[model samples]
Target: MRNMRLAAALALVFILVTTVFLGGCGQKLAVAPQQGGLQGLKKLKVGLVFDVGGRGDKSFNDAAYEGLEKAEKEFGDKIEIKYLEPSAGGENRERLLRLMAQDKYDLIFGVGFIFTDSIAKVAKEFPQIKFGLIDGFVPGLKAENNISCLLFREHEGSFLVGAAAAMQSKTGKIGFVGGMQSPLIEKFETGYIAGAKYINPNIGILSDYIGTASDAFKDPVKGKELTLKQIKDGADVIYHASGASGIGVLEAAASQQKFVIGVDSDQSLPAKEDQRSFVLTSMLKRVDVAVYETIRSLVTQKFQGGYQEFGVQENGVGYAENQYNKELIAANKAKLDELKEKIIMGEIKVPTSKEDLK
Candidate 1:
């Protein structure tokens, strides 16, 4: 009987140990790749090069990071991912693209329009490598049938912010500060002005562009100066499509105790708690979602080339729902929601280019 009891205890110990081990194994298997899916797709290497703002802007760059993170999580062991931050004067873009091509990455994504010329040039040289360009396009550039372009309907989101600004403004005057006067930046400004006019034709707008694309988006000092000037000119609300330079606009707004709208992402989250008071809302452009979706298509062998647009119709861009400032006028929210539904239902069409504006 003693021998039997000892044997039983040993058996119980073995069972408990096996159960623990198996439980852990099960957890690992849950996340493990399936027999023939993306799990089996090995030797996959991907690289992403960010545009001028780099990662900390908490707007465009951050969104792109989120998409890359999603790709990392889903692809797991089958893929290796890397990112490059370009320096001033676009010095790093060509070097990094060349390095990525030399490294034989399976896919490379260039994050902004600044890379249009570089990518167009590099893609032609590295014909066998697959490339994804975001926010810009390279016409007549062919890369071994492996290049794709991703564009966004930024004007669509800008329109929403314009409406929001118009409804929320205590003063009828508003301002738009663009990083550069490119056709792309004008898309945002034109859509915004149209939206404001849609609400009230008499709404006054002060618009200015910061000069060159590279300098326009990074000059916080200039952004601040322009924003203050607008405020003094009777503009109570301001919208900035100026990338990192928009930081100055937000700072100026906070200093002046005025309201400011953001672009690309929810700036309130990144702003200091005190500064957040002036951030009324953000025009959220899900560039990250676009990046992730494009990568996902490649992972799943569903990559589609040509132009892809993200808009309110695709849930790609919109205004933040006043999470930080719950005290927004109820009527304003209601009106915005009504307009959103109309836009979604085809009763209202948001402009895509400046030419679309009436």
Candidate 2:
């Protein structure tokens, strides 16, 4: 009977050991999934709203998207990105921004100045969210702490490209096609005219706007019509800062066998063979670089809110020189380089408005 009791006691001890070991194994399995779940929760959410031309315009909007894409590739699963293109009227812009903010997105960006008012309204309501405005500033917006304005010295870059146009023009007359007549676009117009005059005092400049509204940026029909008008008026080389509308300018230039300068991205890179032949160069606005850097700052917890101005001195803007425009730029390399240095050194002041140009 004592031997039997000893065996039973030994069996009881074995059961207890097995239970403890099995419990530990279960806990280990559960802990791994929980740890992984916690890691997955750490992703940062980002939202972007494109301007009128949207992402495929291969112009300003595409540049912004490129920045987002770059950040996504580098961070991988660490970040979640979403972008929206508002209706042509942009009546949905405010709603889109609010939805993103309500969903607790970490950072949101508005791609054009047209969004300034909408962003300001939503940003005020959601003080916890971070907002970025490109080529746009909401003057006197109360949410200064949560908003950052990214602006560029477009005039400085325009000046460089305009000089190239002047030098490349077969005819003494050139043209400037603008998206709108606002102070913002006026900067581009004045700079182009100033740079042309800097090269040749008597150069004729034919300037026209696609329209008087924000939609002008995407109006290729108007872009083509205006460009044709300029070409008819003896303008052989054209410089356009009209976003997607500039594509039409390129088309017109090619059709007419004239030269053209593009804006924002390296327009020459995406041009068709016919268009490529006429694309002299593009004003590199560095919008993608700016957007990427801003998002990086946010991810690293180093983001600062306020006005951030990028200029030629900051490498924020310049002219693109690629295979399509290499020979053209090479011919004017010395003059263009000299003008760039002068602008950076403050020896040359590129006007930012029609009034300023006067």
Candidate 3:
């Protein structure tokens, strides 16, 4: 009886530990179910932490999710992947990143520029692990082939859509809605302005922002309000880099029957069907491509540290010409391609900052 009781206690302890690790304790880890397991094979473990607006933002974060999904699809047999979403404001981003590093994930990804500092800290602590930072990095900080800064030439892509907006706008007055007030966001804003002015030097462009914080990307109500104000002020076209908040810009466009451009992703698909017609071309930043390439490099043992840029020349950025806005793009495709060639060939330089625009 004593022997049997001891065995039962051990079994119970094992069960409890298993349950907690498998998330029976109420925290669900979206771990991909393994198939055809190699009993002795070592699988690369990967973790990704989302930026503000999380997975369903249908903008930047969603694009990152696509890259994760692609990596899983391509390397499911060789790798295991999991992701976590931060609280609404992303206040605990560093905490979450550090927790993942503490768990010893082999490869981790920080989905936005907000993760620059957090990933830098965690990457340094876990020198053996590789970290991929999207759109952010620690300047001059090297982690011995551990940190890969995945930067994008977002300004070039934004310029394409900005020029498209100028060519198609009926009122000759377009607008821009940015998520936050940062040099990064200014990349989109200044690029858009320069692109528009490149085509129509005398054009009028109205620019507004959702807020001054990360939460700015989550506020669609404010996006709609600002968009409406721009519309009322006689702007006939709008483009937004406000992440989830861009949904409001879409709504405002639908209500007012005005055309709007989208950012990050090919957002025309997610727009309300009725509102889809009014969506102009989108500036495609290829965040999904960047994410996928990072994962691929790691899995293929080609991973290296330092900065990597995704720009038009790299096919890492461009404009979306889809069925929803094929007509507009078709009309401007010639000029758009010309300007794109110029940027790629060094004939026309796109401004990445406001000061450079002059």
Which candidate tops TM-score? 2
Question: Which candidate leads the pack in lDDT?
Answer: 3
State the lDDT of candidate 2 residue by residue for 151-240, as single tens digits. Answer: 999999999988888888878999999997788888888899999989988999999998888889999999999999999999999999
lDDT of each: 0.83, 0.89, 0.89
What does each candidate score in C-alpha RMSD? 9.0, 3.7, 10.7
Which TM-score value belongs to model 3?
0.88
Residue 283's lDDT within candidate 2 is: 90
lDDT tens string, model 3, 1-358? 9999999999999999998877753443232224333442678889999988999997999999999999999999778999999998899999988888888898899988988888888888889889999999678855356899999999999898889999988898999999987889999999999999999998999999988899999999999999999999989999999999999999998899999999899999887799889988788889899889988988888887889999999988899887778876787899999999999999988988988987
Tens-place lDDT per residue, model 1, 198-298, is: 89889998998877657577788999999999999999999999888899999999999989998888888889988998888888898878888888887
Runs in model 3 deviating more than 4 A are: 1-40, 141-143
lDDT of 2: 0.89
* Candidate 1 similarity to native, TM-score: 0.85
TM-score of 2: 0.89
